[model samples]
Target: MTEKISIESNVMDERRTSGELEIKIFNQSDKTRTALKKLALWWGLSLISVLLPVVHFVLVPLFFFLGFFFAWKGFKSEGQVLDGKTTCPHCGNNIKVGKGELNWPVTEICQSCARVVRMEKKEA
Candidate 1:
């Protein structure tokens, strides 16, 4: 009879840092959309913040948080080359595959809830 042996290993990619969570960021189209959106939002919010004193106190913070959220989000929204598949985060409807052209934030909007869903990175 032949002897058999079993072995176990805890191998994982060393490139990934232990403390930091991995994330994927913008593509060419996504990067463009993000830049424009942030610019528009910043300018619009600046106007409101300057035009109204009382409201500015409240709105400025609101927009600041919003801006931060979008900026952070923009960095993670880069997606893989769209295949013929995507799903609506809101409605659960399947999205048809297509190429992006600087309209990622809007173009990828879920038709159901009209909310933006996560996009896969080319690496992910």
Candidate 2:
């Protein structure tokens, strides 16, 4: 038996209740990873600056601070669903996608109103 728990957020409550199946792969995320990669690249080079302890004790602490700061910023920047807005065919109202990739243009339907709308195209 599958259970759904609603997670409250700024926009909507997202949940899914279904029997587990292998074939139905759902929404995939890529933003957090991209942010981490970007953060790693920047910190990898900047870390050397903090390693130098000559006449400065601030280097070590600064290094740690900047390192963590950058990492946090990176992870926070991505993974947020972009503005996935479209018209709800059933309600004739505005709709924005909070998650998921628009793979099949015609297949994506709104859960709230059973409204079918074209998938908002995005580059992977």
Candidate 3:
């Protein structure tokens, strides 16, 4: 007989340390879009900040703070890789697959076994 583990306890522990949580990326394309948006926002804010300094000292600080805040958020946030590791079915060897690159329910030649191995993304 096999023991079944509780999903709540095994998957999500309350006392787990920070940075241990799984970073989930729903769509890989969204990552590129988000980066471009942040770039545009930072550029606009920087131009505004530069112009504000000529107007008044008080406004200069406010614009500078806002510009720095957006820059910090844009560059500092950690990103998750869409790729994951799995075991090859044919030769029992480990393989890495990327969600953005491969289509689900597809097969590929395994390096170890030299056999066609099927890969599918499973939902949790």
Candidate 4:
């Protein structure tokens, strides 16, 4: 499901800001699909590595194992941050939160002030 949500941003200097964001929460099927895609990508790389001369011995096994590992990781994902708009608490400049895996208390850098910004879902 997709929703417009409120988030809070903070800096180490005790600066805080609030912003609105759009996020997508993945369902079971979505997680399964993501897992499959990850598996396919890594496995494909493993297959291609077989054509390499000496590296095939290492790369093939590495990529093959990584496929299962990444698939398991993708299956555990809950949601993703699509995009968001926020203001830098330090420089008071607008910052755009780009697409990424949804992890609580996401940290970003302020382009204007070069300060680290921490973001999290606003508590109800």
Give the Å shift of residue 54 in candidate 4: 0.6
**TM-score for candidate 3:** 0.30
lDDT (C-alpha) at residue 84 in model 2 = 44
- Which 10 residues in a row give candidate 1 its minimum summed lDDT? 13-22
Query: Could you list the CA RMSD of all candidates, in the order they appear?
Result: 14.9, 12.7, 15.4, 1.5
How far residue 78's Cα lies from its native spot in candidate 2, in Å, is: 4.2
Per-residue lDDT tens digits for candidate 4, residues 1-124, read 7998998898866778999788899999999999999999999999999999999999999999999998998887778889898899888889999998777777778999998888878898
lDDT of 2 by residue, 4-120 (tens): 222211112232211111112222234456546666665665566655667336665555567677666545442333234444445545554555322333234666776454442
Let me know the TM-score candidate 2 reaches against the reference structure.
0.29
Clashes of 1: 0
**Candidate 4 Cα lDDT to native:** 0.88
TM-score of each: 0.38, 0.29, 0.30, 0.89
Angstrom error at residue 38, model 1:
1.8
What candidate 1 gets wrong by more than 4 Å, as runs, is 1-36, 80-124
Cα lDDT tens digits, model 3, 19-38, are 11123433545545555566
Candidate 4 residue-pair clash tally: 0
lDDT of each residue in 30-106, candidate 1, tens digit only: 66677568756865786678678678877877776777676656555544232234555445566544544223322
The global C-alpha lDDT for each of the candidates, from Candidate 1 onward, is: 0.47, 0.42, 0.43, 0.88
Q: Where is model 4 poorest over a 10-residue stretch in terms of lDDT?
A: 100-109
TM-score preference between candidates 1 and 3, better one: 1
Best of the candidates, TM-score: 4
